[model samples]
Target: MSGADIANVCNEAALTAARHNEEYVKLHDFEQAIERVIAGLEKKTKLLSPDEKKVVAYHEAGHAICGWYLEYADPLLKVSIVPRGQGALGYAQYLPADIFLYTTQKLLDRMTMTLGGRVSEELHFNSVTSGASDDFEKVTGLAQRMVLQCGMSPKIGTISYTIDRGQDMTKPYSERTAKTIDSEIRRIVDECHERCKNLLIEKADQVELVAQELLTKEVITREDMIRLLGKRPFANRNDAFDKYLASKDEKGDD
Candidate 1:
């Protein structure tokens, strides 16, 4: 995925890097390029006020904390409260697994992490915000896919009612089946939301700590994360990245 993203950048990013006294684009340039492609260019001066900044800090801190505690979540890379893209007040970056493979547990954890922001808002402010619009869209899509496409829904059996691309004009399943699928998807997401919300509440102090620090620094790296929240859940995609880094160090004799 990242390789394809880099390809799409052509040499424009490399050229931009050269202007900074770099002879060639390094991996950091590509990393920044990818983040820009997804999250939009970082808006140096944000539109957020002091209170808004605090909310955003906690909102993003919640995401990082959930990812840290969840065994199946993608490993944390960084968390930031600086505004980026359209309305992204803040975001948590993760080192996702390379493979497309996903088990039910992993999917659930992903949904939980997505709900983290809303959960945090509700916990800290007794309200919610539009910050989680993208998260809910992602959660809904994953739940529906799990049921309708992946056939991971035991209640729905191993039946798939997937409509092919551009086939939305036709009904793939009956009205009753569609209703059932929608209900199931809602149930899955609602349950995960409550579970994640409770976890955030339980770890309220840690969440507050991370939020306070985020408001101070505006960005937190993996080492900063480890000091604040301890090590992530044991061995998964993050561990895989570690192995890759090790190999690179060996080859470069670093």
Candidate 2:
């Protein structure tokens, strides 16, 4: 978050504390402030039908399960079916690793993780909702960057086709190269989609477990996930987040 964002969160936290009749801004207040900043205000009045709620629960569970099992995807922090923001029916939060560089495999795993929700919808419902639009948008942009800017596409060679955002009508590369780039991007996303489908199928039972829990509770934290699925197989990639979870456990916070 930016400096201004941090300031806004602090201000919001103070207000939240005051609203709760607390003398000091507590950690819970700060957490509520951060959630408001990141996810907009909680929309308790925006009610979903039973069917819609089921879809959302499964969608978010798909995200959590994928991240939990993926070797390089970020660690799952929380998953919720609570309606928030303008259009988000549900969300899964992850603790991203503090690293500057990314590997091709890592990027692929991330894409696969993003695709999990839509794939899960397809597998379970035999259809998909518009909820997956944001996932597709991010996946497409990442795949494009991998092919055009990151040189992760072997078929396209180590070439940078990074376009200037200001120039909307000009092409730095030829029409044929543009076609090749499009094809490469499609290939990358398709492979990731298949990987996600396979993983979700292999762990379908775990997805059901998490989805059912989400339906009952509306939210599930990292500790809840560990209880349901056992410990994550991969080693910790974000020590700070692990430490935070540990502190919460030590305090016996719900």
Candidate 1 lDDT tens digits, 1-254: 47776676655477558768888778777766766766777897767899899889989988988988898888887788889988788888777877578999989998999899888998899667778888989999999899988988877889877767584678778889888888899899999999998899889999998999999999888889889877665754455567777899999995
Q: lDDT by residue for model 2 over 7-117, one digit each (tens)?
A: 999999999999999989999899788878888889989999999999999998888889999888888877889999878888887778776999999999999999999
Off by over 4 Å in 2: 165-168, 236-239, 243-254
Global fold similarity of model 2 (TM-score): 0.92
Cα distance off (Å), candidate 1, residue 6: 1.9
Evaluate model 1: give its TM-score. 0.87
CA lDDT, candidate 1, residue 229: 72
**Model 1, 156: alpha-carbon shift in Å?**
1.0
Which lDDT value does model 1 have at 50?
Answer: 92
What is the lDDT for 41 in model 1? 78
The model with the greatest lDDT is 2
Please report how far candidate 1 places residue 39 from its true position, in Å.
1.5
Model 1: CA > 4 A from native: 2-4, 7-31, 165-168, 235-238, 248-254
Provide the clashing-pair count of each candidate structure. Answer: 0, 0
